[model samples]
Target chain A: MIKRASAFLLLAAIAIAAMPSAALAAEDGELDAIHHSANAYYLDFTPIGKLQLPRIFVVQHEDGSYGLELFRSTAAAILEGGWVAEIDHDGEEHAEGEEGHAEDGAQEAHAGEGEAQETGKYAGITLAQLEGHLVPPGGGHVVLDMSISKHLVFAWLGMIVVAFIMVRMAGKYKRGVGRDTAPKGLFQNLFETLILFIRDDVARPNLGAKTEKYLPYLLTVFFFILTCNLLGLVPFGATATSNLMVTTVLASFTFLLTQFGGTKDYWMHILWPPGIPAFVKPILMPVELLGIFTKPIALAIRLFANLTAGHLIILSLIGLIFSFANMFGPTVGYAVAPVSIAFALFIYCLELLVSFIQAYVFTMLSALFIGMAVVEHHHDHDEAHGEHHAEPTASVA
Target chain B: MTLFAASLLAPDLGLIVWIGLTFLILLVLLRKFAWGPITSALSEREDKIRESMEQAEKALAEAKQLQADNDKARREAEAQAQSILREAREEAERMRGEEVNKTRDQIQHLQEAAQTEIEREKQSALDSLRQEVADLAVSAAEKILRENLDADRQKKIVKDFLSDLPKN
Candidate 1:
């Protein structure tokens, strides 16, 4: 009884502890959930604080010459890099008036210049405004804003972690640990299970003799996506796979491999389609070509949407407590916390399943696409397209 | 909220480049350090297992063959031993029969020689008796002639002589 009571108290304490951040977000008048899941210029280690990431921008100067700007942090960008955070209510004309004022008082109030910086046109633009859109000096706009974000850092971390474990496992194999004998340690056995699963189940069935050729890529994709997906569930960690761009690139790799590795039969099936009538051949060509792109596009969107939606759901469930509090009182918030957290916990568990499932789905689809592209089915159309088959038979005779 | 919503689906170029570059590097590095060795080792282990299994099966078959050969040799040795014992028994029976026949013939020859010796001795004894009887008769006749007695006296003498001579 005592132990159970203590566990319940602990749960309640954790629930209550998480509410302050919710309250803080409510005070700031923003949906903390959206803010949490959105891409940001800094890492939000809530309760500890945000760590600002460095920003890099390619800017065009007024003289029509291009220049690159670098900042150690977003704060440094605002303070030292002659940039300022744009005010929410300020329009362009108001910003222009402030730019003139900033030009006048450039040297005097440079230190305490919290309102705007001395930069002429982009004086009033804030860090939020300059997030993906950093305007340049002297009427020149930003050619490219190549700032590092939280997702990128997390992505690199995931990569490093996966690489470290795999390389260490590989070292054991090289030393004849798993090679000569059974896999000894936890890491070796665990990795071997997953690796073999990918080889036998995923790659071999789809890739056939080409399994070895594509095993590395399949294994890499599986572990990398799995690690990234799991990283999102970690506290203060972001899901890199949740990013559309990340999935897009991954899917595009599959796209490139599929196209390049395509066999002659694959092209023939798409272009000429031996079984199809002459009238339908042209129509089928466009559809087949479109299918080539849609496959990868669907791959990207499915992974991105699944991760994002899962995170959004959990975040929303947690946000419910704050929404109730803002609408009613702290009492109401406290009342709703348990139910909100219970549901969030449930969804969080579901998200764990979703993470694995999404990774597997992506890799499976990729393999399937590649498998379809390289499939050699000489006899598939023999029965269905007997007209074509009869002509070939007659020619042979 | 709308801005954030838009940003959610927005594809960031920097992120794209980072993901592309880093993923490629990861793929290359993992292929070198991890996948290559791991897969080769797995296949190597599988091959070793299969080879050992095949060797075990071969050894088992060899053992069975040796057992079968030993059984055949033992049966052949037993049959040879039985045949030798039967031959020895037949030879003993034939020799015993020959010995019995020879002993019986020797006994018959000894009996025949004894019979011939007995016949010869009987004949010789008869001849000697006959000669002795003839001499006695001649002496008795002379004695009777020399005495020249009457007929009655001669008759008594002959009777008396005959009674005294042989009690025959």
Candidate 2:
């Protein structure tokens, strides 16, 4: 195990060392495609772009009433619904022409200079321009554009896949395929192994005796995170786990479970520590309270950052090839191509590992936190009260 | 530079709501269809495995017990066969000794009776021969000397011969 780890470390180190040579002076279009986080809610095929998902928006109208609208594409929304891009909101400027972008100062700073305006087919010009700046139609009421995004679509896709696979596995198990007999075939074996792993390696150890009670939730979370993470690695696929809102919701589940799952003993230790003197309790209570919030926040941030960072690094590494080509000449660009691709491939492999590891880490920490809340520790056996008789409720499985 | 350097950093509240609702629905649905059956099946499989192991152990113990019983029965049968063989050998020896002693007594008695019979027959033949010889001598003396004293002489000769025999 240690040998494998060292080999991985060496390869990663070599890739990092080789990366800096060509990581400069990339074209505006290349950087925007690779580095810029904002992408139109469309599937970018291998050479360029492909299918665009439906655009759903919660927009406010001139009548001061919010409305939900759906469009087949962003172009339809703009042309049919009279929605305008941020740059064209006042009707003061036509879409920027190709020659005009060369003279435009602000557009020159951002790599994708007038790329959105140059295109006549795609709507909203570029989502980056519309960031927090979507004006209501006729400027009559406040509008919160709750538009369905690429990541949201990916999130639903991940959820559907997880559900489909789990339901099938569950059906197999229900049919005694793996119960009374030895687990058969690839799917059943994989099914049995993964669930058993969570039960044995993750749930049982962390949650102790309460492992059975919370096993369902732990299994769901693990598989859901795994599916979402793996979905991101697919070509033209957006990673839902990289999104803050999605991770926040997932972590919030853990937070909710941990807080509500807490026993009186667990709360007592935080609210009023037994062994500590009265003077020390005041100073410790706030810290303990903050700890409750921090656990989930940390869970959320850790997953989001790890997933997002891996994608960014891979994007940056691939961007190096174009940067080199633009900087020197075609020969130098061709020369650096192999090295840049090699590094990007290495980072890609690392991201693959990170996907599984991050899912595992999130599930493990969630289990640990839940266990801390629910499991009755040996230390909280004070013989003070005979009155409190509420039955401790175990959190949802 | 763009004002939002971290464009993806801030989460939209609507997205959170969408995720929250989606996850809740997923949790409820999964708990019913997926987790319920999956966990129960897993536990059922575990129970089955444990029961199978216990049953196998029981069967092994029963097999071992049967082996012990078989050994014990074999030992008892061997001991019974050995005792029967010894009894048969001892009875044969006793029968042979009794038969030998009775045969020896019977042979000794037969030998003694035969000897007595032979002695009596010899004595009778001797007596008859002496009488015959006395008659013949009488007849010869009468013919030769024409004397009537032959009968008395034959009788005296026979009596003298019988008296002289120590066997009487």
On DockQ, the candidate that comes out on top is: 2
Which residue pairs in candidate 2 have backbone atoms (N, alpha carbon, C) closer than 3 angstroms, thus clashing?
A217-A397
DockQ (0 to 1) for model 2: 0.36
| lDDT: worst 10-residue window of model 1 chain B | B1-10
* Docking quality category of candidate 2 according to DockQ thresholds: acceptable
Compared with the true structure, model 2 gives a TM-score of 0.79
Q: What tens digits encode model 2's per-residue C-alpha lDDT throughout B1-168?
A: 122334567547767877787788778778899989888888898998899999999999999999999999999999999999999999989899989998999899999989999999999999998997898677555644543368787677566655664564
Clashes of each: 4, 1
**Candidate 1, A1-397: lDDT as tens digits:** 9998997576556444544543343322223465567777777654455567888887888788888899877767765776655433233224324434424233332232332233222354343443434444447667776888888888899899999999999999899998999999777888899898888888887788888888899999999999999888776678888888889999999999999999998888788877757999899899978978998999999999999998788777777876676568879988997898788767766877898898888887788778767656457674655553354225312
Per-residue lDDT of B22-123 in model 1, one digit per residue for the tens? Answer: 999999999998899989999999999999999999999999999999999999999999999999999999888998998889899889989898898888
Instruction: Please report, as a value between 0 and 1, the fraction of native contacts recovered by candidate 2.
Output: 0.55
Interface RMSD of 2: 4.7
